[model samples]
Target: MSATRRQVLARTGAVAGIAFTGSLTELFAGTAAAKGMGRAGYGPLVPDPKGLLDLPKGFRYRVLSREGDRMLSGEGEVPSNHDGMAAFGGRRGQVHLVRNHENRTDAEIRVPAVRGLTYDPEGLGGCTALTLDSANRVLGERVAIAGTSTNCAGGPTPWGTWLTCEETEDKAGTNGYTKDHGFIFEVDPTNPHRTGAVPLKAMGRFQHEAVAIDPRNGVVYETEDAFERPFGLFYRFLPVKPRGGLGSLRAGGSLQAMRVPGVPDLSAIQETGAAFDRVEWVDVPDPLAAETPIRFQDFGPKGITHAQKLEGCYWGGSSVYFVSSFARSNEGSAADHYGQIWRYDPARRRLTLVVVFGPDTDVQLPGEEPDNICLAPSGGLMVAEDGEGAQHVFGVTTRGEVYPMARGRQNIGTPEEPAWGEFAGICFSPDYDTMFVNCYTPGTTFAVTGPWHR
Candidate 1:
């Protein structure tokens, strides 16, 4: 971390670029640019004059929605803390975005508790739907679901709906909550009322993060985002009524946690290309967490595997890809590492370590703590960084080369005390033409279009 090394991709506080200025292309001149590093992903990021978003050449982003802005649907002001999201094809080639608001009761802007779409009046986190035309213009916005707590990351259904998960197990009596939180709710972009805001209690009630549905049989794989002792356990749900329409998961399902025989802690495998085969799943004695949370529950001597900061997942090919954001031994985790992306093959009952970040002190961009991930339209993975470095959405190549695709530049705080937000909800439109992501803190959504390297 010398001045010269810092200059390699120097990220100062100002050109830290919310109001932080500089031609990033010039800064990268002698290093990546001069060496022709743009071939990695799209090339090094060029600075933005507006200081909103930084992208590579031939790329552009439109600020689709901002927190506190009036909705085009006239529902209410946009809610804050945008987290996970998904994109669907709407009529006439329009795009429908079901975005998650990770708000709590004390949020600056709560998801408008629209009469019927509201789940619980006391709950504050929910999902919003926006219809954007072919030009990425917002046509209408509406609250798809509300009155839920900690609506973090969830995946889209192959049947054309969004699954929004609550990342909390907040009890109703505590913190003025009127209903118990932490359950997955299905949302139909075409019809919010059809969702009914009913909590899919069968999906388990612990700190849910993101879910990936196995299209082969409609089995849902879930991740936990807790750092509590005993950490978090990855879960799998087998819907009783598999693969139906919007309200199908409501029929209830059997929930289970993944257990790799000898690997109790996923962080213990620190190597990049390591693979753990023969995965096992144990039924959850109590998916509702009526007495104890699922992670802390007992499974006799052969306990389930645990990973820290389990977040973001999606179905890829015949497997489910998930993220263990980061782990620190001092935090009671079994081992320490920057991040880990795992591929679980349900057909073979195996878990493979597809990507592993740093255990080093310097947590830079690209490989640092990859959170929400999606299969890039062209190929490989588009990972959102949620670590100690300057936040960015990195593109990891098939050859394992990490490239900075987009950097967060919106200043959530004042220019004098600039605070940048992390990128989340990285998804592409159905036709794979536009990418949608969120700047979490002050809550901004961006629709990015670029010449993808397909």
Candidate 2:
């Protein structure tokens, strides 16, 4: 069984009573100044509830698809445990959504034709494409892409394509196929009828969870979703040619991991829940060939350090925003397990912490954990809830105005189910009037649409 965040925290000896640098009241009081949005509000827009989905007033949700539903490909049923997703504009006033199914064959809930890069009658988990109208109505659903391991969160390219990332680094022959694992697969939304799959091995193989590409430079920033080992590192894949297209990225590129110079071993400080204040950067060897990239710079006080497990990443104004789920505060008192959001500005080559959520701030109602995140249409952020009770879709305005956009419906699985409350992929439509969310458990997707108030 995979270790839960709580399990990992316990193993690291993280507990209460540690002194956090920012007090709960101070953190909440200085929201506007800290977030740089002027005066703003900080509370759930909607009250917490017990269900699978929830939304603000005047907004409604429709179930796009559920596990066990048949698709156009003649597949038996929709796979269980859906994860990351991306949207593409299609012809005939339709939108194509490429979704990820995070199921493995070993699990009890299984969907066929989802082994490692090959259709296995017994394995579950793969990618599917759903066609929707401009009004957020489903037109047709099909397996636009398939045959991958633990398909997780992925980013959409500017070239109108979807990059689906595999979140596993297990060798090919160990569990599933003999082919390489942990590679990004390109999906052509313009041509869903294509059969063959293209794997971009040049992106480097590791426990990749999410990726964001810079349109100007064609550079891809990735995050590692590792738990057991302390080797997870932030990586960047630089395309050989400037302004190169995604097609060229498939050919090859240089992969470099991030390093912070002059800092002490972050891993040890993290165990005590201490956050680093200094900043540094060291580039790893280019074109990292082995499964593990060589460490070129030692930024931590101790020689050579392991990187924190990075989850969601997005390219925003002038910088790349990423999240580290288990960063300690500087005081070495409290651990920010809920996670801290950071932004990396390539122009300045610096990293800055934008938001830090702890128990009091995150555990607002009863039980809740921050998971996947996306940029809001109004220039803020929308975070998916992967917590207990009912999962929620939350919005944080640029000014740090936090509100509840939706609440989960309780029909599919019990709150205690591991897959139940996890909200994975989230993205807004091209027009910015509609939002689509993927529920990891029960393997379902929801489209929420309404008029823009602002």
Each model's TM-score?
Answer: 0.90, 0.78
lDDT of 1 by residue, 1-454 (tens): 1323322452532122111111112211122112323345886788889988889889999999999999877889999999999999988999999999999878999999888888889888899999999999988898999899889888888889999989898888967888888899999987899887899999989888998888889999999998587888999999998866778899997999999999999989876557777789999998999889888888879988999999978776677878888888999888887777787888788787766665234433234566888767665567786754356787754545567788877766665555578889998988878999999987999999988744
Top TM-score: which candidate number? Answer: 1
> Residues 1-454, candidate 2, lDDT per residue (tens digit)?
1335543332232323212222222222212212333322232233325444655556667789888787755656787778898887777668888888886646444544532334333334567888888777777776656666777787888888777777776555758665656677777665644433667777877777788887778888988776554446677888776476547676677776665554433333333223344444345543323555333333345443344556888887566767665643452312335556666677777765556544544333322345688766544567775655445566665554455566555445433543335677898777667788887766779887764434
- Give candidate 2's whole-model lDDT: 0.62
Error (Å) of candidate 1 at residue 220 is 0.6
Q: Deviation in angstroms for 236 in model 1? A: 0.8
The models' CA-based lDDT, in order, is: 0.80, 0.62
